[model samples]
Target: MSTTEDLTKDLSRIMQLAASDPHDIGPLLNYGLDWMLRLAPFDLVAVFLLESDHLVVKAARGPLADARVLRHAISLDNFTSIREALATCGPRLFYEEDHAHGEGDPFDGVLDFPHGHACMVIPLCFGGNAQGIITFDRERCGTYDSQTIQLVEIYAQVLAMAIHQAAQSQLLHQLMRESNERERILREEHQAGDLLSPLQSKNPAVRELGERARQVAPTPTPVLIHGETGTGKEGIAAFIHQWSERRRQPMVKLNCAAIPESLLESELFGVVKGAFTGAVKDRPGRFRMANGGTLFLDEIGELPLPLQAKLLRVIQEGTFEPVGSDRTIKVDVRILAATNVNLQEAIGERRFREDLYYRLNVFPVQLPPLRQRLEDLGPLCDSLLGRLGRRLGKPPLLLSENTLARLRQYSWPGNIRELGNLLERAAILARGSVLTPNLFDLSHSSDVKAGVGESPTPSADASAEAPMISLDEAQKRHIRMVLNRVNGKVYGPGGAAEILGLKPSTLQSRMKKLGLERKVHFEA
Candidate 1:
């Protein structure tokens, strides 16, 4: 094909590709680089896209550089030819090695082509401003003729539009992420207020726990929030972060158990670009995101032993290297860890590092389970209802006297979360404003009154000598009663295991040891 025909054909395909997938131009750029090599006299061609004030090799053809070398970010301010070309670019940076016309060009000392006899530069423009540069270099001692230069310049224009399309897509996605992040922050701040409401109540223990949280909030000490699952551990963690000096910054969180063991380290620290197959871009992990704020690691006892050592180092030194990158990054993140599992038990099993446990336990705070502090139930229900009402667009939410009394009767194995979920359900179900006890299904709740799961004590004279059940019998009867209450369901939501605050697997294991089953309630 003629040179003009070739340029027309290549430019047509490039425009079609740009219009089709503007978000990613990798395939288009790579294919275009091949076409450029075919069209130009140069043996080498490279496309340097501007990113954060540096020109990075976006694509290349021939013996220009290796894959790693292609990513090298040469500063635009430092490269004279690139700077001048980009600034006055409808006029190209015409470099002839024999004459030194464009001296100290082509990334100067940084990225010089080994066989460069002469080179031509084309500044890429989008919206009247230069966004990148295209360099064509040849081994033979000869300058580009006018016709070849003009054809190549046409190709450069086509390439520039593709680069701009990719950049715009990236910018649009980034703006959307930022907008969603703002909305999430606002939602959290409101939830934090609700979480703090129980701490402000007349209950002495709840008030004291809040006071301890307030005392520790100002310090940079690492806080360990010890509590059962659904006991508002996350809420207390958020409360501490909100009352701290770094409240204005982000409070990023991660649940250790929720992520797989292999991927947890990268999530906590970070991953460098090309670190693994999927790691195409650098991810600044929770530690970096929570810099100058707090990183709350929920279910912390599930953290594996190997990562614990690295975590200990970060806690002590405030520095960690991202996965696959040797460079150390430092951050001033306040660490807050929560766990339903006993770390001491984990330490005894040799599953957790001893040193990491001590480092994270500097300011330990325990959240009392809801059943233990029944006095706060009224206040908790009120706060949850008001929030749920506004969120669900309901008229109003009210807990009937009978419902509150029944709430106090049940042993809330699920704690505050269960209460909130229960209230939300009630509000959804109710035709009127009043939420009755029937909204809390009998199968999901227990008959254990007063304190949760505590057996009633007999007066000294009445039952001192009465025949007492054996410990095994007592356990068997209790398990049977809970199982019967839930109608033998063990694993799904509203199961007996959940009401008993035990993992279904663990519950099954215990049943095997005690020789119990779904239907059998052992007794005479």
Candidate 2:
């Protein structure tokens, strides 16, 4: 066949494959790269697919085809030619000699291509928007003529269309899967008719909270969950999302405290290319991602004051611009925010915006501390044990009656999370199906409560003959027991301070006030 006929046939074949199965972009890309190699002599070919803010190598041909590095992502800022091509939605060419002025080759450490060559980078543009990049590298310099570049651009356009079609198909499939999963969950919920089963609390405070959640779940009102750390705030947020009318849509979560302030804005509101040093492409923020769904912001108090104003605008107007773009994008997102800190106190300190707090606190739900709801301890233990048992491949560890009484005597300052940690440790130490108080590290149970200026009460079944000591003497004895258990180690994990749930400094201060020393002798 003539060259023109071959080129025409190749383009026809590409269209046929793309139209045959829009869900399979892998075969299309692989076949296109092979055909391109046959049409033009090239030492290497690589295809990078745009994902969020980075280009990921989706397919590669030539010597390094099987290299594990192909799976890694390449930031747009790392390559000048690719960035330029993406910015202009066009092709870029780089020659080895162009970097003779001591500027190192861009692909020197990136790819193991043969030295002293030329590379052609074609931005995959569809509908005047760049989706990704396809690069061709030749061992010989200046191998791509004007006609060849034009042909490459045309091929890129075809590939871009196929990729975009496949992406849309994948998204459709994802939506279907989410719908199915949501249906399954709704079916189970309907069958049980209990949305608060996950909370597993019989305590009146928890029951009231669950009832409040049920009442607010059907509304589009913003919910602000307030509690101390480890008080199951996120769990409450998840419960709210599952019970809400928008349960079919995903609930995207972000921890304001986990992300650094410098990057938190872009993470929440997203950014366009050149928005910052590493932003290589336009990306959607959590608000856009959570459109028609719920956005659960954990540790909402930790959100910086500057972003607080932007977040308030989104709540009020349902519109905001990306980090670098002035175009205001509107989204319908249900806000569900949680905070362990007191936002009112933060407002008083001038650290948090008072307006934002009011916006989020439209339907406030405050969770009770574990100590206040001691009646739920037994059920919580059973639930946690069942979960941990299955995860650890062990039978459920049963807590003895005496152990329950012992647990109820001490106040849990860390709440449910601390109880879980302590239970996990005891479960690991337990040799039989039954767990005893000996398996736990509650030696400082009285001391920890005392350190916080709380009095520890004895179990209900304590013998009548037992001597009653002053609170200070009881605290001293408890602290002494914890120190003895760890062999005088005061700091670090598994030490007296950690096991007692007291800060090292606080533990030391209590020890000094009680006239206790590191070398103090104890009864074995």
Candidate 3:
């Protein structure tokens, strides 16, 4: 047994170690155990910290020091000695020899302790509150004396102060980390809001489109957005996803036309390990990643017929098998599909599935071409310049009156995308801040030639004048003239669609019926 002088020296050493490094609880517990063994050798020593109503073993010595044993928790209701010590804010002792075996014993032969042993549980109290419990166990009976118990009670008080300070510091650090994460999320949301602000246009067609988007955003119904290429169909899909209830979750996107047909199936549905050549590991597909969220499939018309049927299954049943596995995985993904091709015409040609079209066309949102919404041109130009100027680290470029007039007269076939590209190019060429009409390189553009609404000047000879033609002949002549001016480019910017004010699909159908071959090569 340790004398009073020896116990006093040990307590001083423990306090010194704790004062030097208060954050490290391991060293303090180690020194306390050393002193405890000198007073009365124990089979096990466990220090359990009080976390709410449960005791979590923070440190342990001897046979019970294993990770699994240390992690085990003890409820206050399960142990009378631990509960008594916490209630009295002092120490309590329990001996197996003093209790009956079957019905009256507090341990009841079920507790994980040494058989036929004595235990001393001292509650570590500081500031009139119990912080933790330090338990000591010995194989022999009557191991704890009154003097040893009194010394340990003093040691428990010092340890409690150190533990309470450390816990408060850890909690503060956790709060700071969470605060930083919230700030980062807020900043990203602000930037995304600025990017979508320009979509709110004053044009009647665009306002109607916004209204339609808001109407369908809160539901699970699939939406199909139709427009010409570069008409912001994908942007509308993004707006719907952001406004939906699933906005907090991720929105996965896949461009059906950008990926190859052979790889499209595996990309949409996940693949297991050894399913195919070079597929060494299991990979999750976009559907699984976007579970409980939204999935935007762009250029959905480009999906092959075989995959289209499989896609319809996912839409109808919310379940699909991987490319090579027979296991069917279930997901709850809301789909939003976009396409520039005319599905009705494709259905007539027997190229697109009618049932699949009906399934995807739950709510159709059509975006008008830039030419049809010419009133928004000036605002769109200003919005684009402001955004692009920030990205380029330069001031926003101003458009002269002549340059703005020319832009308004020329038909925009590529819609907002073409206008944004033109502004970006002009901004780069602009000296200081002003942009002139001469900076625009539209000399070879067919839209520029047609916008003037006049043909090349004829020679000053009266004999060169031709007679007036029939309306049917005149329409044919005009179609052939624009097609020739653009060198047969009919679909994209500067194509016949821009000059004729028609969709690409409509123009292709008209040309085919008019017996006009589309093999004429044009400069892109």
Candidate 4:
């Protein structure tokens, strides 16, 4: 085709493509470059944009220089000609090659393009602001025709419009993505935020544990969660998935011990239609359902020995066969296994596979019991109280000083989960705003009440009753009292940190400063 016809055809196509898929700039720029080469006598085309800290290669079509790596950034203050060109043209075309020694020019001393024989520069503009530049270079000598130059300028204007619209679309897309991410995070926080606090503990070990949990949330590494039964292992697993790359995907859960041994395989790996007498239809397994997401195997230690081998095979190969089916289906999933039972012991007993243990234990996060974080008790109470109060729709409840003091003296056999349950119950029963000593359920705090009743005795109670107690003695006594109430539990919902109205992390820090034991407990 002739130059005019070719330019006409290319420009038409660029406009069509931009109108059809206005969100994409790649297609529009590529079309422009193809025609700009054919209509003109240029062998190379490059597009560049000055980003915040560096220059970016927007588009390039040639075999000359390493244009990808030739992302040269010039300071706006230092390179005045380039800056002026941007300020003036902003999407205009320039044919100047040796602009360094030009009269009345801002660039007094600069290197001209010696290797680059001749150049045609086009500024990319949007909304009166210069966005970038598109340059076409030729190796041999030739002056562009007036008609050809006019045509190129017209095409450049169209190209600039396409670039601007594409950029606006991309900016909108990015804003939407960020907004979705923020909303998702806020929802997850609303769902799980009431369960833990950062200021509830001052112990280093507890703080370290919380930090580990936070750090592991964004990773796909298989997490092995270890803790007592009421320690909120499932909560940790959910936290990890909520903050991970696979947050949008499903979080499948199965209690290994809850399902019967005979049905466990079908439950985990799914079953084909008519596989067994009760099999009704082709079914997707938990692993398949949790594809591109997380699968939480609660009480992993209870998985039958025979099923353990199958589980191991699936974990290793990402493929599993349905019950009575030979065909293996593949899936992508992150495993999060929680067990109150000691996995090492289970492995020693030949109940759990060693290979599976290692696979799930890629990142092990152990939850501390409630008694360990006395400082967290207070905040945990506030959180739980708020939730329960909202659920019950009553006046805001307050945990009385005496009630909290009494709570600090008991050993919580059930960890954070237990504490949440206990507080929820207490909050419901509390007639007034205060959670008094009558609401306490544990047996360990009997002595705290007993000691409170006796008027005068020559025991620790006598010394504690004195009004002129030293600050050192008072702090130590206070610490001892809170520890006694919680029975030394720390690092979870409703632990000592919750009762104490502090973050488990903050309490942990204070404990380190005080040189407290790793296992902090309350003793009346």
Q: Pick the candidate with the highest TM-score.
A: 1
| Model 3 clashing residue pairs (backbone) | none
| Poorest stretch of ten by lDDT in candidate 3 | 102-111
lDDT of 3: 0.72
Q: Root-mean-square deviation of each candidate, in angstroms?
A: 11.6, 12.6, 12.7, 20.3
Model 3, span 383-447: residue lDDT tens: 67877788788886677655565576556778889988988998887776876665666555555
State every prediction's TM-score relative to the real structure.
0.61, 0.55, 0.51, 0.50
Q: Model 3: runs farther than 4 Å from truth?
A: 1-192, 195-199, 449-524
lDDT of 1 at 473: 47
User: lDDT of model 3 at residue 92?
Assistant: 75
Q: Residue 334 error for model 3, in Å? A: 1.4
Q: Write the per-residue lDDT of candidate 1 for residues 137-254, one digit (tens) a residue.
A: 7667667888777877777787787777766765566456545654576567666676544358677977898989989998999999998889998888888888899888778889
Candidate 2: C-alpha lDDT:
0.75
Give lDDT per model, in order.
Answer: 0.74, 0.75, 0.72, 0.67
Q: Which structure is stronger by TM-score: 2 or 3? A: 2
Model 4 lDDT tens row, 366-464: 877766666666777787788778778878888866556556554566767777887888877777877765665554433233333323221222233
Q: What's the residue-level lDDT of 336 in candidate 3?
A: 98
| Residue 438, model 4: Cα distance from true site in angstroms | 1.8
- Candidate 1 vs 4: which has more TM-score: 1
